[model samples]
Structure formats: C-alpha cells, structure tokens
Target: MASPIKVCVTGAAGQIGYSLVYMIGSGAVFGADTPVSLHLLDIPPMMPVLNGVCMEIADCALPCVREVVATDDPSVAFKDIDAAFLVGAMPRKEGMERKDLLAANVKIFKVQGQALDQHAKKSVRVLVVGNPANTNALICSQYAPSIPKENFSAMTRLDQNRAQAQIAARLSVPVSDVKNCIIWGNHSGTQFPDVRHATVAGKSVYDAVNDEAWIRGDFITLVQKRGGAVIAARKLSSAMSAAKAACDHMASWWQGTPEGSYVSMGVFSDGSYGTASGVMFSFPVTIKDGKWSIVQGLPIDDFSKGKLEVTGKELCEERDDALAVCSAAQ
Candidate 1:
C-alpha cells in the first residue's frame, strides 16, 4: 500500500464535520486504494466530542483510515498535513453586524492559516467551508503566503449541486443527466446559478425545460436560498448535504474532473469574467493533475452579467470589511 496521506478537518465534532469525517474515512474524498491519516481538530471545550468521534472511527475499522489524531491545537492538527477542510468559523449571531462576524472569523482563519504555513506540507490543499466563505478563504490564503493562492478554495460545489438537482427535477430527468450548471460569483444569495450552457441528457437545458421564465426566476432563487430553506425546515443548518458536497469537492480536486466537464469552486479571481482580482470568486473550473483552471469563453448575456456584478460587488465589500478588520488587529 502507498504511504497514508495526512488529512485534517477542523470542527470535527460539529454536524457537518461528523458526517464529513466518516465520508473521508470511507475513502470518499481520496480513492479507496489510498490510506489516510486523519487529523481531527476542534476547540478545547469540544475535545470530548471529538474524542468520541475518533472512537467511532476506530469502531468502524475503515480500511482506508490508517491512523487518527484528535487535538485542540491548530499546529498539532495541521502538522505535515496534505489537505485540510477548514470547517470551523464564528457564525453570525442574531444581532451581530456582518462586519462584526467577519472580524470574529478573521481572527480564527488568520491563526489557522499561520498554522498551515508553519507546519503543513508546502503543497497542502485547503478548502474553507465556513460561512462568508469566499472572504474567509481570502483571509486564510493571505496569512499563508507560502502556499500558492490556487491551493486555497472555498466551497461553492454545494451551490452547483443544488442548481443541478433543481434543473434535473424540473426536467423530470435523473440528476446525473444534468451537466455544467455553473455558479457565478460569491456563494451567497447573490450567486448566479447559470444554466445557459448546461446540458440535460444531451439536450440544452432551455430546450429541455422550455421555461426561460422559471429558469431566470424561481430556479435561480431556489438554489441561492436553499440553505436558508433547509435551516427553516430543520431548525439547523445543512449538514448531510453539505458534507456530501464537500466530499464531491475534494474528490474532484484530488482525482480530476472528467474530460469535457467542470464544477464551480470559489478560487482567487484572476479577473476572469471581469471579476475583481485577489477576491475568492466562484467560477466554472476544470481540474487536471491536481490543478484547476477557470473555464473560459462562455458567452454571458446581459442578465447574467448583471447578476455577476451584484455578487462580485458583495464579495469586494466583504473583502474590504475583512481587510479592515485584519488591519485593526495589527
């Protein structure tokens, strides 16, 4: 067997992390042939819960999991890691302003990013899953100057999956039949779930659904607000689906997306599609040999262009707020 790759997940005791750890243990993110040394991190107060999670993983006897490390220290958890799921962050409280929440998370990610820079493998792949993810990712990458900006990405695969599922349901086709449903800009409600270039079982989505009005209206809103809808129904944020999407994200990153296909990831923008540079923005990206490139040359209609502008503006504002917070700390 090949040497076990070191994988770390922060917030390993939380709902999403609970589900995510099991998936990783089962070789969902990495291939079944590859063994993984799992490093699970949570806050000191949550160590008991994290320990219990480790115990459960031991009980499962998953062949892919070679060893497990549970710790409260970011340095310990990040040491020599090959990849990480940065799932922990300060959530927005009921009365807290957006800038306040950003300030709180900026502290969290800044510390973790330093840990990654000091201890993790130079080629470590990092995925930031916490809310305000695009800006949080930008913060994390900024603090880890040793790591390539391309190695850092925020999760927008969840949004893309939601878009594909909605399209499939609308067409009454299997979800697998949906392809290339792109998520443009931030992961927030301003994201544009563009189906303009999507195909449904070898036919154009527009040709298959025959409802441009619904596609431009309800479909976009539903995918954008699906997280809130889930929270309303379950009285909890999305965990199971979020875990699955994270797995899909890492797996695609590890093993390249199939030829002629792509997925959405919030990566450092290189001014693609007129987005601001240095901000983490979601775009349709294809992975190959463990590297991702933005899909180029997709024609953007006026409506899609306007939607991109909205989300891009939101991200820029968030990035500025986060930078102000970081500057204040220094």
Candidate 2:
C-alpha cells in the first residue's frame, strides 16, 4: 500500500460528520486504493461523543482508516493534513439574523484557518460546509494567506445535486441521465439552479421536459428551498444527503469530472462573470489534475443575469458583516 494521507474532519461528532467519516473511510471521498488516516476534531464538550465515533470507526474494521486521532485542538487535528473538511459551525436557531450567525462563526473559522496555515500541508484542499458557507469560506481563506485561495471552497454540490434530481424527476428519467446541471451563486434560498446547459440522455433538458414555466418558476425555488423542506419534514437538517454531496464534491474535485460536464463549487472568484473578487461564489467548473477551472462562455440571459446579481450582492453584504465582526473582536 502507498503512504497514508491524513484527512481531517471538523465537527466529527455531528450528524453530517458521522455520515461523512464513514464514507471517507469506505473510500467514497478518496479512492479505495489510497490509505487514509483520519484526524477528527470537535469541541471539548463533544470529546466523549467524538471518542465514541472513533471507537465505532475502529470497530468497522475499515482498512482505509489506518490510524485515527480525535482531538479538540485545531493544530493537532490539522497537522500535515491533506484534506480538511470544515463542517463544524454555529447553527442558526429561532430568530437569529444571518449576520449574527456569520459573526458567530467568524471567530471559529479564523482560529481554524490560522491553525491550517501553521500546520496543514500547503496543498491541502479545504471545503467549508458550515452554514453561511460561502462567506464563512471567505473568512477562513482570508486568515490562511499562505494557503492558495483556490484550495479553499465552500460546498454547493448539494444544491447542484438537488437541481439534478428535480430536473430528472420532472423529465421522468433517472437522475444519472441529467448532465451539466449548474448551481450558481449562494447555497441559500437565493441560489440559481439553472438547467439551461443541461441534458437528459443526450437531449437538452429544455427539449426533453418542454416545461419552461416550471423550470423558471417552481424548479428553481424548489432546488433553493429543499434544505428548508427537509428541516420541516424531518425536524432536523439534512445529514445523509448533505454528507453524500460533500463526498461527491471532494471526490469529483480530486478525480476529474466528465469531459464536457461541470460541477458547482463555491470558490474564491477573481472577478469572473462580473462577480467581485474575494467572495466564494458558486460556478460551473471542470476539474483536471485535481484543480478546478471555471467554465467560460456560457450564455446567461438577462433573467439569469439578474438572479446572479442578487446572490452576488447578498454574498458581498455578508462578507462585509463578517469583516466587521472580525474587526470588532480584534
């Protein structure tokens, strides 16, 4: 076997972490041939829970999990790690403003980002899965100046997968048939799930479904609101699907996507498509050699342009809010 790669997962005792760790150990994130050592991190209060999780993982006899280190220290957990999943963050409760939530998570990510800068491999790939994820990712990347900005991304594959499933259902075809489904902008309710460039079994989604009305109206809203729908029906946020999407996000980034297709990842923008720099915005990107390049020259009609602008403005405002919060703390 090859040398084991260290994989660190924050919030290792939480719902998504529980599902995610198992998947990683089972070779869902990395390839089955690659050996992996898991470094699981959680708050001090969750130590006992994290220990039990580690024990269960041990009991699973997963060969990929060569070694496991469960800790409350970010530096210890992140040390020399190859991939870090920033899944832990403050969850918004009843009546909390989005800005307040962003403020609360800023300190956490800032500390973790500093730890990553000091301890992790320079090439480490970090994915922020916490809520207000796009802005939170920006905060994390800001602190880790030594790490390349492209190495840090927020999860938008969940939104993309949701879009793919919805379109496939509408077209009465298997989800696997859906291709090039793009999720633009934020991961929240304002996300634009566009299937304009998508296809189902070699046919354009528009031609296959022939329902422009639903695609422009209910489909977009449904894709954006699926998270809330899950919370309402289950009394808890999505765990399994979220974990699966995180796995897909990492796997696809590590192993390149299809030749003509792309996946949505919230990465730091360099003023692409008129989005301001420094914000982690979601765009359709193709991966090659473990690096993602944004897809260019896609036709964005006036309506799509308007929606993109709305999400971009929201992200910029959130970035300002997080910066103010960080400044206040200093």
- Find the candidate with the highest lDDT and give its number: 1
Looking at model 1, report the run of 10 residues with the lowest lDDT sum: 90-99
Please provide the root mean square deviation of candidate 2 (C-alpha atoms, Å).
1.0
| Tens-digit lDDT track of model 2 for 1-330 | 888989999999999999999999998789998899999999999999999999999999998889999999998999999998899987655445677778789889988988999999999999999888898899998899999999999999999999999888887889999999998888887889999999999889988888889989999989988887887787778889989999999999889998888999999887788877778999999999999999998999988999999999999888888888889998
Residue 117 of candidate 1: its Cα lDDT?
A: 91
Q: In candidate 2, how many Å is residue 149 off? A: 0.5
Q: Estimate each model's TM-score.
A: 0.97, 0.98
Assess the local accuracy of residue 113 in candidate 1 as a C-alpha lDDT between 0 and 100: 87
Candidate 2 has which clashing residue pairs, if any?
Answer: none
Model 2: residue 276 alpha-carbon error in angstroms: 2.2
Model 2 / residue 85 / CA error / Å: 0.6
